[model samples]
Target: MTVTDVIDRVSFMDFEPATASFRDDVLAGLSHPIRRIPCKYLYDAAGAALFERICELPEYYPTRTELAMLQRLGPEIAALAGPEAQVVEFGTGDGRKSRLLLNALDRPASYVSIDISRDQLIREAAALALDMPQIEVMAVCGDYTQQTLSLPTVGRRRVGFFPGSTIGNLTPVAATAFLARCANMLPGGAMLVGVDIPKDIAVLEAAYNDSAGVTAAFSLNLLARINRELGGTFDLSGFRHYAYFNEDQSKIEIFLISQREQRAAVAGRFFHFRAGERIHIEDSYKLAPATFQNMARAAGFEPTQVWVDPDGLFSLHWLLAPL
Candidate 1:
């Protein structure tokens, strides 16, 4: 059936009010000297849907590459994770990877899906619970980056699942801190993280700047979200999506550039934008395998094993927490 049909099977915990953080972050980010928005706010329902479409685009290799790798290596990953483990996935978008992972794990104790998008989180979690009735499902709605999440206590080990190379959205320092927090949260357990590898500049840029314009739509949806949620007066036509690989930073930087001078109001506050002025939207950093391992080690995790696809487009890192 549908997600609503199986909603009762999923346990949901909402830690953040839907709009407060969005409003506050929008105001604060727009007020900055260098106009920017926290990339986390980009996952409203519409944006999430656009992202799913982007995953299917031929230019977007990360999702397909990672999924293939997971399908091929699921058993090996399950072996490292061990049996009866509680799988806690961060930013559990659509729970596609989680389903594959939980299927591979031997009698996984439970599945905890955390995400900022509440509606999508509940929908996916409910569906997952229905599909895998043997495992318990708990859906947490919150910005995992900002909140100290209270997870369920289970006798078995807690395995953290962070797929989709979303870690690249955070700065290196922030990623390290985030991993350290995961280490604390899943003590004596382990983490399975998907990381995107640095590739040709043209390939990197094409992934975000797709020919079908889906990625552009995904970027612009942020403004639409603000207009709908925060009463923002943003003229969607006044801006254009721009993304490029910054070789120095080793990341793909995405921005919305104002086509002409204009002003947009959000939450009763107005902000001015000059022609060609850019509002930084996202950064997807590509770290080398050795570099990421070092960062994980610095974050109090023992880098156990890393599996890379033959194409060298993506990698899955398995890290162990100290006993």
Candidate 2:
């Protein structure tokens, strides 16, 4: 098929959360005693671009490390997945890792990319469809955490891909629930997941608090997004990005700390912040391989294989869902 035909054949499904949803979420989250915001909101167009820069930072090793491991393990993963597979990827990002797997898979039949960022999801899915015309591509824009995924029936076997250690973004309870949902979605198939391994405090902390300040920009961009989209009056300069590895939690906790006592309005609703008060934005939980496997088993996935980097910095797991 021609490139135009490939693009035309690519199905685009948008289930993006509405503007009202964003307003409501912001108003409610800010109303809490300890102000907070969901990390998923940090992926507006600008925030997503900022995150791409974060992947290249020297301190951010997860992206590059995971990419390298996928390069080495692609063929093996493809072998286990077998032929005529339908690959459904969660949080598809820039579609870099999916390309590696699709190229290695034996005549893979279709690819479904589910991401919350609509523009990136459409752009990346269309480009992937154009580049790999033999496979069908479906772009889904929705929050997998909040909604049930409706996958198209095309390929023989469905293989789920969740890469870039994105699973770390969810709490343990949420991660297990999310995996259970994936199991329900891909029964009798398998899931290939990228997970971050707990490491030295310094390394984990540095990954989020990069020296180049891209991560900071990414965190602050959420407020900028609220201002542009929801009539928010947030002084981005008044808050500083803060991230640290919480050893007790085995996670990297990220927040935007108010430099001084201040009040900001989001959706015409005002909230006061005390000096040094933090708005919790994200938590990147680092789970050991065995711990993760146990969680997977609890979620109804049989953990069959796991690959760890030489330095034990990252892990890739192969989980099989019962029929």
Per-residue lDDT value at 37 in model 2: 90
Instruction: Score residue 18 of candidate 1 by CA lDDT.
Output: 57
TM-score each candidate. 0.97, 0.97
lDDT tens digits, residue span 99-164, model 2: 998998999999999999877887888889878989999988899898797687788999999998
Q: lDDT for every model?
A: 0.90, 0.92
Residue 86 of candidate 1: its Cα lDDT? Answer: 95
Native-to-model Cα distance after best TM-score fit, residue 303 in candidate 1, in Å = 0.3
Candidate 2 residue runs with Cα over 4 Å from true position: 1-7
Query: Which tens-of-lDDT digit does each residue in 171-247 have in candidate 1?
Result: 99999999999999998999999999998899999999999999999999999999999999999999999999999
Q: For candidate 1, list the clashing residue pairs, or say none.
A: none
